[model samples]
Target: MVAGEKIETREERIPLWKLKLDPTNVRFSHLPGPLSDKELEDEIWKENETRDLMKSIQAAKGLIEPPFVMEGDGYYIIKEGNRRVVALRKLKEAVDNGEIDDFPASYFDKIPCEIIPKKIDPIRMDIMLAVWHVSGKKEWDALNKASHIFKMHRDKGLTYDIIAEYIGVSKSTIKRALLAYEECQRFLKKYPNDPVGIKRFTYFDEFFKKSYLVQKATVDRSFRDKFMEWLAAGKFRTHRDVRVLPDILEDTDATKELEKGTIEDALNTLYRKYPDRGDPLWETIASAVEVLRSMPRSEVKAILEDQAKRHLFSNLVSEVDTLKAELNRIRNGRSSKLK
Candidate 1:
């Protein structure tokens, strides 16, 4: 035959012994035989498809050069073309058992192939192959696939590392992106109509844990839709606009002081003296009150005295439970006299 010329009239039947499995070929053949009846594979077994597969095996008059060969002997090992080998084995067994005496001889033909034996590490193949697949993908594409896997893992309530390993990315990246996603979710929920894009999300884990606003923003549709719409409008030009409030909001003491009008009243006085003490002073007074609350009650009097000496006459440092009780007593006495 001329070089590169196709061979005309090749023999249809390949001697079962001469055919060999090739690892270099990536193509797989349809297995004709009944697949190994493992319990695990029962889901794939459809009785209705059996007749179709059988008909294909019988009616396929054209010669097919299979990519790999099945080893006839000891402990079945498929080197390559696992599907084809399985199919051929099934057909041969059925034919020999007189299940179908008359069938196409060409079904077992020598499929033109170059055999390269596969050397697999049985113990680590699944893990290693999974890793290779993950690593080989593009970063953005990997992120997409990772996101899906991460969602599945989360649905199953698994960790980021397990999902990362399953999808083949570093656990740290998964964690970071997840944090970003969660934070973005919070911001999006808070200002759903707000035009704060994902680029502006700042993940603050502690803040999220404490903020009812943050949780509400993430879950409440009224808040979330407005924030997203506003964000989409390009209202927040920088990440600062999307910045998370400080963690002091979660402080039990700070919350109580706010309720008691200490922090808010002090801030109003500060605003009367210096007009720019809006958010900054609110934060300061809240933090200072939190610090005071964090302290022991035994030390509160001394702390209050020291702070008073420093001219820090915020409502928080000045008010005492004793003084509040005394005022209540005075009010009650006045009401009795009026009666």
Candidate 2:
């Protein structure tokens, strides 16, 4: 039960035909029009692990966990486990056609379900779904999660605070998801026929989270469009490449390399221009400093009390001192050359 809303639920076995797929399901929200049951099943089949789930269910002979649903007049609307339902339906088809004969048709005919009353408040229902998929177990992929958050805030007109409170996430997380979702939508509008572009939600999400990149894109529409074009062109090898975009954008040579060559080429150009930034030793030292700064006081006390830990700490200090001396010597050598 979610706070402030009293939900009435009952367990029952529902016929497969009587269970309706939710068109507003976050997984298929990108589709434009009303979808038939077959269409919903087709869409659900495209989800990750659907085939694996079908095999798992075949071995188990039934669902391991019942799907959650809402009671309708003559049917029940599935709120969770659409993929599982699709798997069952497909398995049933196989059985009807005699594809595999391990299980009978009866196993797939009636599915166990946890049915919530349709009379429940719509907002509460949305909140409950958000809690389950957004922050709870049975989590949706990043794209679906962001799309759900976007709909709740934009279509349902729910405030960020309300969503964050209900979904057990920070308000900033909700806002970031909404921003990334909107950007992805804009990308889709530009390339409506490009189905593969929707899968790059993580690239857009990571891009929006970087303040430097966001500021640049916010102030310059051309830069944003160029980034979109790069995304659509599949220039970024992975989403991690998006993390170094700020550095690439800051360097003229690196940006040119990125436009013409690969992300690796652009990174090489950036590293060449700022050699110090690419130094592994400097990075290690910086990471060490960060770890030390963030270490808990309890751990620090334990280290002080333990001889082995204190010895290790002393060695680390000695290494830092040696590094500092070497850095000063190099600096002084460079100063002498300038003189």
Candidate 3:
């Protein structure tokens, strides 16, 4: 990794774990999503870290995983790390593009670090971004926050699964929250029009982003009164399930059919047979149907193969050889009878 050492191209198949680090050629993925805002905000710490990193680079001259590069010549931002990379880029771009009129005192020391071309390694970068969002601390907090509200409503005689999705969390999480909400009756109230209000609350993104306690105290207070009134009337307590009307114009025909209960008996029978296959299952099946509807005849086999692999249902995949063998066996039995 020294100045005399060779730099390898992307095509080189060095095991990802084996990269040597050098100050000159050391690589790190600079995607925005991976960096937390706090890490990016600290200028002094970053400078010291960079300086120490360079010293290490001069000593070990080893390559770590080649820095993750994004598009063009800049580091690709996945989420949290964008600030750091962006800070570096802003300085570099200003200096290199001659955009700077009055260079700051720190500019001289920082400009060299900013020289990294902002290039995104698309494939790995995308996977990393998805991984961070799902597995990151921030997303977990958001999910937990949404789940708290969802459960609270459920304990006050609301159905949780449907309510959960409106707030952006899984049904199971909503179920867990209901247990806690039930015990927090001292803090909660009931309302007559609370369901409608709760429905409206879905549009309030600000409420969902905060901690559960903050949300319950500040945002839900007005609605809590309505919930208590509604409880006295027993409207929510008696309600079996909530049904939302479809907003799409194309769905008018289906909606009418559903309202008339022409399909009700059949729908009930289907549900009884497969109780676990709810709306979620229908959503998946509908998506699959849409894919099949758009597929061309020539691509059907390829599509089937892809589906089989994804579903792990390769046993259901039929090849021409199996069909031919079945046909041959039938033909041979007929020929022997004829003879």
Number of backbone-clashing residue pairs for each candidate, in the order shown: 30, 0, 46
Candidate maximizing lDDT: 2
Cα lDDT of candidate 1 equals 0.44
Local distance difference test, per candidate? 0.44, 0.86, 0.37
Which of candidates 1 and 3 reaches a greater TM-score?
1
Candidate 1: list runs displaced more than 4 Å: 1-161, 164-214, 217-219, 244-339
| Residue 329 lDDT in candidate 3 | 100
Give candidate 2 misplaced runs (Cα > 4 Å).
193-195, 219-222, 273-339
Root-mean-square deviation of Cα positions for candidate 2 versus the true structure, in angstroms: 6.6
- Model 1, 1-339: lDDT tens digits are 111222232223345435433331112111234333332123222333533444565567322434322333432233333334435545665766778667654444434432322343322322232343345431223333334333444544656665565555677666655654565656655655543333334323332333465576667747545444444555434434333222223445543433354444433444454443457766676677677669776665664568663454455346756678899999999999999
lDDT of 3 by residue, 92-177 (tens): 44555677545553443321111122343322332233233333432423323433343335333445553443344567655544
Q: Which digits, one per residue and each the tens of the lDDT, describe model 2 over residues 1-339?
A: 774877878899999988888877888777766888889888889866999999999888799999999877898889888888889888999998999888865768898999988788777888888999989998998999998888788888999988888899999888889888888888889987764767778888899889999898878878778988898776788888899898888899998998898878988888877765678976776787789999999989988799999999999889979989999999999999999
- TM-score result, candidate 3: 0.20
Model 3 / residue 54 / CA error / Å: 3.0
TM-score of each: 0.26, 0.78, 0.20
- Give the clashing residue pairs of candidate 2, or none: none
